[model samples]
Target: MSATRPGSVTFVAVLVYINGVLNIIGGVVILFTRDQMVRASNAGAIAGITTAAILSIVLGIVILIVARGLLSGSRLARGLVTVVMILNAVSGVILLFNFQFFSGILEILWAVVVMYLLFTQRANAFFASRA
Candidate 1:
């Protein structure tokens, strides 16, 4: 059941790690700028903003965990990454509809690339062997 680690898997893992780091930074920024954000928004929106920031932080941590698992060729990691990539792709589509063309397109492209890499024959074999 031995299998070589695929380049695609490596690329996907690297990208996931980088994205996770960015997500962590964004979440931290949101937390730090909470005061100004809360002041600018209405009373009800304040709670939503806080919740979003917290969720972002949690999401970032989860992403990092998944990425680490992926490097170890975990089957669960592949499933988790697939789910995340799908959600990201959907979000990218929504972004496009909201007129954020560039970002939306970039997001979609990145998600697609990750998805492709994960499903490659070599990647699949590597994960299966590790299982």
Candidate 2:
């Protein structure tokens, strides 16, 4: 397999680390804030929190996977990152529209960073080297 550029690998690693940290934080909040969350007892709130926690965990896993792929200079990683970024952007927009407060802000930032990293010239060069 071709080696990835150090800069690209480093960039992706940073992204992965950030995503993992956020997921862990979100998970802890969801798991620990159950009582506070339950107090509202609104089915929609409960469902939304649950969904958010689950998605955070899943996104973390995906980020790790993509990081691995990127480190190995796999072309597939670019495609995966693209898909994930698109989904994140869409979700961020939806969350903003839904007025999810802090969560919306986080999602928007996440989407922007991911999109920037994935679309940058350095990222394209890294993928090209693999080809």
Candidate 3:
């Protein structure tokens, strides 16, 4: 990879990889401790929480796969990451209104930085050349 390309693309890829790993770990922890959560909520809420945990795991795996593709400079990966980042940013906004301002802002910041890197000229050219 070119020097310019390496800085942005590599940074984004690493960030995505780390984020995916953390999400997977967090999801697994939630799934394992689900009983505690269920005890405090209704049956319907249990199902909803379980579904969210499963979705988190699934999304984490998808992010990891996308990160691998990104290392290869795949344009498809860039698009996929962009979509994920947008969704994450929206989720962050929801979290903000839920009184989790610090975590929400951090999430939003991470997504913004990754998105910015993914859209940089160097990153675009890198993927284009590989394509």
Q: Give TM per candidate.
A: 0.79, 0.58, 0.73
Kindly list the per-residue Cα lDDT of model 3 for residues 9-98, writing each as its tens digit: 888889889989988998999888888986765888878878888999998998899989899888899999898889989999999999
- In the order shown, the candidates' Cα RMSDs to the true structure are 2.8, 5.1, 3.7
Candidate 3 lDDT for residue 116: 93
Q: Candidate 3 overall Cα lDDT vs. reference?
A: 0.86
Candidate 2 lDDT score relative to the true structure: 0.73
lDDT per residue (tens digit) for residues 1-131 in model 2: 44347574568667777767778678767856755877665878777778878777777777777777777667787677767677877787888898886787787787677667665776677778777
Compared with the true structure, model 1 gives a TM-score of 0.79
lDDT of each candidate versus the true structure: 0.88, 0.73, 0.86
Off-target runs (Cα >4 Å) in candidate 1 are 40-43, 90-108
Position 40, candidate 3: lDDT: 65
Mark the regions of model 3 whose C-alpha exceeds 4 Å error after superposition.
1-5, 86-112
